[model samples]
Target: MGDFAEAVRERVRRAREAVAAAHEAGDVYAVAEAREELDDALRMARDLGVDPGAGPEDEHEDPR
Candidate 1:
């Protein structure tokens, strides 16, 4: 479980860094790729038990 969390964190961090670099380089395609990678990491995190939705306090709000 801990290993999975660490992997997800690492992937997310790398994706964010890539996005920053892409922005600095003015590469729109790269930015889009990074965003996709970040989304994938988020999905993996959710699969590993991380809630990818609003918490109890935010339940009243529509998720969609």
Candidate 2:
């Protein structure tokens, strides 16, 4: 993977870890915030030119 991909992956991994820790500590808000961070990382990946899958048009359609 390129630098951008690696950076996004690291962000996602850290967010997952944060969520797990927050869950164990019973912090709902922290978990939600971590999830939001993960979502931002995904957006960053897309902005960095990563093709995750089909675009919005395919959301309601089945891909074979």
Each prediction's TM-score against the native? Answer: 0.70, 0.63
Which whole-number lDDT from 0 to 100 does residue 9 have in model 2?
67
lDDT of 1 by residue, 1-64 (tens): 6676777777766776776677778888987897688678767867787643432213443111
Count of backbone clashes, every candidate in sequence: 0, 0
Q: Which candidate number maximizes lDDT?
A: 1
Worst ten-residue run, lDDT, model 2? 55-64
Cα lDDT over the full model 2: 0.64
Query: What lDDT would each prediction earn against the true structure?
Result: 0.65, 0.64
Clashing pairs in 2: none
Query: Model 2: per-residue lDDT, tens digit, 1-64?
Result: 6776777767766765676677777888987897687668667767887644433223543111
Instruction: Give the candidate number with the greatest TM-score.
Output: 1
Q: Give the TM-score of candidate 2.
A: 0.63
Model 2 / residue 2 / CA error / Å: 1.1
